[model samples]
Target chain A: MSAPAASLDAVRPPVRTIGRDGRRRLLAAGLVAPLAAFLLFAFAAPIIWILGYGVADNELASVWPRVSAELRDGGDELPPDEAVFAALAADLRGSQASRTAATAARRLNYALPGGRSLVTQTARALADRQEPDPGGGWRETLIALDPAWGERETWVALRQASGPVSAFFLLSAADLRLGADGLERAPPEQRIYLAVLWRTFAVAATVTAAAIVLGFPVAYFLANGPPALASVAMVLVLLPLWTSLLVRTGAWVVLLQDQGLVNGALMALGLTSEPVRLLFNRTGLTIAMVHISLPYLILPLYATMTTIRPELVKAARSLGASPAVAFWRVYLPQTLPGLAAGALLVFILSLGYYITPALVGGAGDQLVSYFIAFYTTETFNWGMAGALAILLVAATAILYVFYARLAGPRGLSLG
Target chain B: MTARRTMRAVSAALAGALLAAPALAQDSVTVVSWGGAYQDAQREVFFRPFEEETGIRVNEETWEGGIGAIRARLASGGDPGWDVVQVEAADILLGCEEGLFEPIDWDRLGGEDSVIPGAAQECGVGAILFNEGIAYDRDALPEGPTGWADFFDTERFPGKRALRMHPAVALMGALMADGVPKEEVTAVLATPEGEERAFAKLETIRDDLIFWRAGAQPPQLLASGEVVMTTVYNGRIDAANREEGRNFAFVWDGSVGSFDYWVILAGTPRIEQAYAFLEYIHRPEVQARLPDAIAYGVVHREAADDIDPERLPDVPSAPENLAVSVTQDLEFWLENAERLTERLQSWAGQ
Candidate 1:
């Protein structure tokens, strides 16, 4: 019985070693698994969690759970019923004791201009007070501590912010607020973010168009010129890309300032009597952005242009077409993919530029990303940062969809 | 309110956490502060000497400065990785309430009288004092600007000027320039009409203004002749003058001044060493060394006795400089930051 079994076990070695193709596939997956895990945890997860904060309404409710509960079940009362007040009283007492009242107050303040002080002041006033009943309920006590608590607006803000989910930040991104009656325009004094969003788009488009115009000739020369010249030119184009973005922006500052090299040269050449206002305005911003983005446009355009056969344009010219018509009809269409890819690249990169503009451009010329940085670093308002980020991602996605539609089946590809 | 509650609530939980805490290999205390040149100066003045004098292994790290950073570190476990941290004034107030910091023993720091007014807090001791004032490149603007008024009067100064992008110092400076008394700047700013008044003053200079975000940018802006005058940290102007021989003159009139405090994170095992570190920094000798390294004022007023009398007027805490300066009303800004920021941005966009 043992002799046949022993022979079968020895033959099973080939099956254990497995197929060569399967082994290769396993090795490839093993090599890529670390990168895949890194992208999931470090990159994708944080992005999703941050984006979640854009619409999340957890701050106020999480800090004052009892108040959130009362609001969820409070029905259609103006200043909310006495039960809501009692719940708020209990919640504030607990939050105040835990020193989390300020945290809850901060979220409320995002909706109401002076809500932070109001909530903290009230909580502090009630710090040592016993819980009130029907004999003397919290409605009177709360209203006395701050008369704003008696107002319908305060209750409404609380109700909206009492959330499993809410639209406060998302709506704010559009320069709108969530009123009891749905959406409302933000106050005139506060309606700047929407304009900032538009400015971001405008700047990105300007940079993209400028880069294409400036880069196309350079790209054409690199593609059609001698191979040795193209290699040297390629190195020159990538030189700026190798430097820190901040350094490149700083170099622009030195070149473009009122007393800087460019202005000095212009004055010496008798181009102007005085230094033109080029350092901290849209003009300067466009020039610096174009300089930084030109290489990106040139690289891709050259890649696609090199692939186009010169014989196609020559054939069109031989068929009795004018040189301009031949170039436009035959040669230009072939480079469209790269041209589209370069524009998309420059536009998206320019959209997120904050440091360059913040350092070199005037306050009026700042993009939406500046405000995102402002909120994240300066104000510590993560919800607002998340809102601006979501606005940017959404706008970029929509633009990408539109660009893809226009490009059609040939599509945009970074060659 | 927050300090008392946070201390009680967190201390109770922290008591149990300390039992599970692991033993350290050395008697080292890590202190975190704002990085760059400021931190380098701190190392030379406070960190290096403290290690030699007390034999406590002083470990140092730098942060970009945020309350959120402190909150994350302390909330991970009561024993925050770093022991003593230098935090902004608002963070001291906010963190105290959240119980992220250990309550200071004023007796250990030679009592509350040892420090300047507003330097002593329930949970923190003031580590450094800074002032933001109008600094003009003397070469560019031959007639140096005297105050925030000249800064706003573009016709008089005759060129673009840079102001901090934030409304905190800008609003106070604007109110002072608009003729509100230095002491009453925050009081007037608390009212809606006063808010509009400050913005109106800023509006006068909006076209002629470029905003700066970083402390280092203002000096660079001046050096580049991008602006004639800028609202800049006094220390930055001093550093530029000393290092680069840049003739930038700082005007103390209508300056906005604030403090950065040293706080011990709650439940740190190095409580005694943390106290010793705080005490060491407060010593008049140690405090005197700071002003020479950087132009910032020493927290201890008595440190002036050791400081060169000639250098006294250059600091924010000097009576002459303090008289003209407005201590930044952190509480007022904390309440209205969002409103003022958006309003300023809206005005700028227009």
Candidate 2:
């Protein structure tokens, strides 16, 4: 009987052996190809272009490779004396004008009182048809324009201003710069952007923490309530999401402004004799952002929490654990996944917010997005914008990694 | 059935081509310009007549924010989307700097003398109307202040006054208020001391001031009584006064005059069409209609012949209206824009 069974199995040769593998391979390819293609074309390609724009040495694309090659070939030493003058002549009077030179001029003109004259003179000399000999032309040009031009400080200032994807923008975000001697130093008068960055992070974290603390209890109540009550709570949760974000932010502005509804009510109630300055302040910003971001935190948590079984908690209670004990031991453990997810979601969203802050907050309350927008739109500085974007993307990825490590898989309990 | 469907499709194609042949024969053109009265006047007089005479279709695309969108498209290494862009001189200056637009071929368009002297130039051709000046609610201050200084005098005026947020307008207004003569506006703006002085005066009124970022905002603020006085576009204030019957009126004294021009983007596929659009829009009849309709001054001084001179004062097209206005220093503004704007925002923060 065993032999017959073995023979029968062998005859059958395991169902769908050859065709199944082929179909499975085809199915996998079908599932993944579109996503990969979309990422490659839409996201990766443009980002690569932006990165390339940031790194490119000059307007003429070919100059980038030649400059990079020259930098690599020179190693640690400065170019030879002959090569230096040749380079200076080529850089100044070459057929293709340096975009960096233009950017440098623009930036310097902003900083120094007499910088515009130096820039225009340099530009005119470079653009002029009368060519000076390579021997002392650069020296003469440097001396005629600025005595300080020979010093590395001048070049460093020019580089900081021009910033063709140099680490300067990333450094500027931190209020730091490469000094005359090539060491990283704090910005002028020893001012550091660390405080601003810290202030920003603190605000974002506070907003996120507030949203989560407020959202979790509400989401828990909604998730554990009776079906009819849960449905009503769900509607209430979704109500803000349906309203326009701008409209909601505007409503907050109306409520928070010194002479607005909330202040008027407070004053009328004799809560304060003078109208408290509510609009264009930190308190108003926090209140508005929390209201705006509350739904984002709550909705995700609610979705995650509702999936947890009530039977597990009931079983714990039946086994002689108190209600609070059962909740702490069973229900709370299951909601960890939701808590972790909500915190991260709210934190990331809050960091990139632009409109809410601009409308409701004062000048000092502006986030990093405001600076990014200023660079991109007002100054038309794509290189700095691209670098800033890259830094932001790096920060977000690092945060995600940090979050993932903190919330280990075991921390996520499900029914 | 499929064969029959194919046959139907072929016949449809044939029908379309047959119908389109006359339009093609006439050298059809399409222009993309700002929507509303400006576009309507262009359609009624220039485009319609041009089509009648030249047999060009003269289609139009109407939208606001045309220049910025076109520049972005050009920067993306794509073909410029607009055949013709009706933009102001300042926008043209920006476009020229970015290399996003081509210089107009004045030899081909050929209205060098017909265009207001100093209007026809390399980047664009002055198409329709100029705008300048300050407007105020007459009811709020019945005495009617004339120059920028009186405009800034809150003690005399005793109400909220609005100004444009742009440094070009703000700096000029500030200096003029601070006793720099109208002729010396540009010279003052060029110096570091002048900018500082202007900022100093502005700092005093910063609390009472509301800076408007858009063309329409100042007029709106004036009409709503949110501001009792403001520096406004001449036509916009006029239109608001007419529509809302507001007590506001404009003072051309110490106003920086600017003309909006019609330009073609550098890499536009339809150059001939764009030229046709420009040529059509500048016709005197078309130019005349726009001032009454849109409230902008027409570039063609001859266009005012159609409208009564009494009405022309109300319209921007009047030469008397144009005479009192000061032209802005475009090159200086272009050179220092980034620094000035950043400084303005930073100073405002303080």
Best by TM-score: 1
Query: Estimated TM-score per prediction?
Result: 0.91, 0.74
| Worst 10 contiguous positions by lDDT, candidate 1 chain B | B16-25
Please, what is the whole-model Cα lDDT of each candidate in the order they appear? 0.84, 0.66
- What C-alpha RMSD does candidate 1 show over the true interface residues after superposing them? 1.3
DockQ of 2: 0.10
Model 1 CAPRI quality? medium
Q: What would the per-residue lDDT of candidate 1 be over residues A284-320, giving only the tens digit for each residue?
A: 8999989989998888888899999999888999999
Which residues of candidate 1, in runs, are more than 4 Å off?
A: A1-36, A133-135, A180-182, B1-28, B76-78
Return the lDDT, model 1, position A106: 85
DockQ of each: 0.58, 0.10
Question: In candidate 1, residue A297 scores what lDDT?
Answer: 89
- Chain B, per-candidate TM-score: 0.87, 0.81
